[model samples]
Target: MKPESDGGSEIKNYLVDKREKSSSRWTRVNKTFTIYDIRLKISGLLEGSDYQFRVTAVNTAGNSQPSEASQYAYCREPTYTPAPPSIPRVIDSTKHSISLQWTRPMYDGGADVVGYVVEVLEEGTEQWYRATQKTLKTNLFVAAGLQSNKKYSFQAAGVNSNGTGEFSEPSVEIEPVEKLSIPDLDLPDDLKKTVCLRAGNTLRLFVNVTGRPAPVLTWRKPGIDLQSRGFIDTTDSYTQLIVEKVHRYDSGKYTIEAENPSDTPGPPGSVRVKDYTKESVVITWDVPSIDGGAPVNNYIIEKREASMKSYKTVTTECRKTLFRISGLEESVHYFFRVLPENIYGIGEPCEIPESVLICEVPSLPQDLHIVDIGKTSAILNWERPLHDGGSRLTGYAH
Candidate 1:
């Protein structure tokens, strides 16, 4: 083949030639034989045409027979349509828009990728619509102007100079919706049970609230405005209504309500004075429903003359709910308050609903005597010199 590569004669240059596969005539591709390397860059070929190439080594000997014809090659354009891209994924959504993203195609069909085309299809419709008329250079796009609660899917195709590529598979179905959590009140069965407390008993109601976004809260008693004495506290987790000294007028259905982003524990129940008399009274009460996370250690019973604000402690270690208080001044009005103690300390006092008046029920009559007596009958007599209490005798049972 040229006597061991040109019989040791330095090769001047290489002649590159090409021929259409349809004919046998050959044509030169270079005006000068200057290529000295094994590789050559071919140019100026009609697209979609098939041809073959051969190389002729030229030296001082003038020429060498053209190398056996090389393999046939298609002379089409180097760049072609891109391949389909990766499946798209939904990134974000709103009532009016949906955002999607995808990776560039695995193959750009021999050309540098230029842009992408996004297409969408609505639920319950067969037609797929182009999201934008102009191609997008980014791999991400947000399809706007979507109807609320409408389900839609999207597909993407790449673009280059050659043309648009095949569309990628459709993305997962999506339904655009404005996010909001309606405020809600969780009412326990205890809240629904009718309360049967006495007039002086405290009324405490606790309610739990929940929502995706925290909700604004409101307490409603419908027709009646709450008394200044009543207290209510609201927090993110709970709502508390505390009517310290509830009266008959306070007996009614209480409702705790709230409103979401889209919309909107306290002390013991009070001391109750009952079955009171001239020298003694029975006081009973319930512990505060919420102890601020502490258990009640004991209850202190306090009493004061209705005319005074200060109170004298009756007992500091009373553990039971009911207590019998004695030595009260007969016919004098008194007010009583009770406080619960825990590890945290003494809590707020729960006072009775109203001032109580010592009862006027009379004491036992004076010494009795028998004025006359017989085997079958006896005469009863008694002196009225003893205290008459505060009220006149209504009658006597004989």
Candidate 2:
């Protein structure tokens, strides 16, 4: 026992006893003692017997009051080693880092657990390295600066005043991977095509993309552009542009651009008339060179007659590139044009020459009859037709 007062003389001996009453006889447990001595052993006790012990200090000043009785103890060898810590398991991970968690040891060797130690082993190596510089007071730890695509294992151990306990079983292996990247565009091959849309028709363009650190997209037109006034939407892997209506002036090259830190612009897209008849014309086109990393929404078509100075839209929202314009006047010279539209806006126009003509087949002749019949031949007569189809009729064949 330590001296209660610093001014007191050094302790000479200690009086010990195993009784509750102060009047009971006491026994001297230690004869060879020192002033600094604080621990003692009382032997010769029977196993499974209840016993309470107290001690008193004998200093030059006087014998000090006895200490409170210690709790009963069953005679047995004391254990100072702790059980192994619970298994360590991974909780989170990244390309170069891993986090782990574990439970404390099941048996603490009669002492409170003070901290834990963590260790890791790389794949293909037999050596284990400490993950933390100091013991961790909590059950969780994050190990960082690991190599990507490599496997690793981990283990944990509990610590107390007695020392570190045995390590837990090794954790299952794990591997880290690189983050996702921006989309890759298959360049010149994709640029060769152009997108075409009919006037007054809807257009939808889709752009498919892939990348790490995913890319951002924007749609653009080369020259003075039509207002988008349309919806543009995007997804994890693709983007889309929608045009409700299209016009002739909407014709031109459209560009779709993608960027993350790097930029990839697609080739220019064009629209044109495919075929035309007396009353209607068909238009078709390819997709834009670059989709601006987004899909195209729709296309637009427009037309103008030879007499009109300005072009009029035939369709506002053409879904497809091919379209047929009907209800044209016969014998009238006209012009047909197309435009490609995306969510960005309408592009430049692809127009045909203004010399296209609307013509129809001739009508049948009237009052045709057989005037006379002969044994070998018959004579036929007919009146001139009401309509000449804007051209003189050649002689008819019987």
Candidate 3:
């Protein structure tokens, strides 16, 4: 709130200016004191830029002192409501109602998901209707009063304090019926995979089966009973067999006597360039959060000058997460990225936060002094510059 006194004069307007946290210069947010209210919306600021703003009130008496600068803020897009929940599957049903279940969305947008909304599209219609009268706190809901023998497609959306978000992809269409489907076993992707791992690595074997009520599971590997070695976990939808810290003895084909599901590696962590020099930099990164479905086989490195439109691969056979890229030109800005490769394929790439300047040549040599003097030549020595453009000096010029 403005001061009650206002210095006994009417306030005309306020002037706003901003300064980047790393810079000493301040830039005017508004060219003129045209803002008459206390609240103002500043635009045209670059995203991810750190900045602070100060305000000055103008009146007939003249401009009041600028208010203390606001806290440093990182500019970014405003947050919104949660993203859509996973598609709703028909878990159970009857002639008059269908019970649907779904998983939460991977992204909650920005806020906690307070609840979910289910919608249904009837057969031969374009529009959809809300299946649930209220937001459901649980992951399951029953669409009561579903017309018997009518086909319907279902979708689910998430809700948070901000509001509702986009709907999930529609679930498989199903017709309402009293009798349920037949018993069956299904494997995701119909994939019979041979998982490769190093000794001391963890291996997971999972299967999901969809059948009428229940299906029995039997896991074995030729001579040994898997239950005696690898432990098992069973949930309503799937079962997981995990073997931790495997050795050469554990290397063999394993089979799931009875069951059925799903990523690529996420982007790598921040790229380290602290050991950069005028012509080279040692880049390092943390492994991706996910390794698709298998362990990372290798990493790919690529770099591009800021002015270039495409990146050139530096190496496709980097086995480690750290490598030194040299031959970079001095004073040029560069962008480097790394991608992880697993049995599946190469995942998305993670890039340096900003362009890097290979940087200038080494700083000037310090404490130069002539020690030995001769009639024909002189010997000179000096202390090296504190910063060598981040590298050791190959030699020195007289």
CA lDDT for candidate 3? 0.80
Q: Candidate 1 at 221: error in angstroms?
A: 29
List the candidate numbers ranked by TM-score, top first.
3, 2, 1
lDDT tens digits by residue: candidate 1, 1-398: 33256845898788889999888899998876487776888988877788899888888878888888888888765678889899888776655777888999999988889999999999999999899999999999988998743579999999998888999999878876443456788887888789778878888888898764467777667576664658888887888888876787787777666875331014557678788678999998876765543346578899999999889999999976789999998878899888887655788788888998887556787888989999999999986736666656667677
Task: Provide the TM-score for each candidate, comma-separated.
Answer: 0.31, 0.33, 0.33
Distance from true location, Cα of 186 in model 2, Å: 36
Position 200, candidate 2: lDDT:
83
RMSD of each: 31.4, 30.7, 28.6
All models: lDDT?
0.79, 0.70, 0.80
lDDT of 2 at 165: 89
lDDT of 3 by residue, 219-303 (tens): 7787777788889886556778899898888888777654211145678888887686678888999877766544566899999
Query: Which scores better on TM-score, 1 or 3?
Result: 3
In each prediction, how many residue pairs overlap at the backbone (N, C-alpha, C within less than 3 A)? 4, 57, 2
Tally clashes: model 1: 4
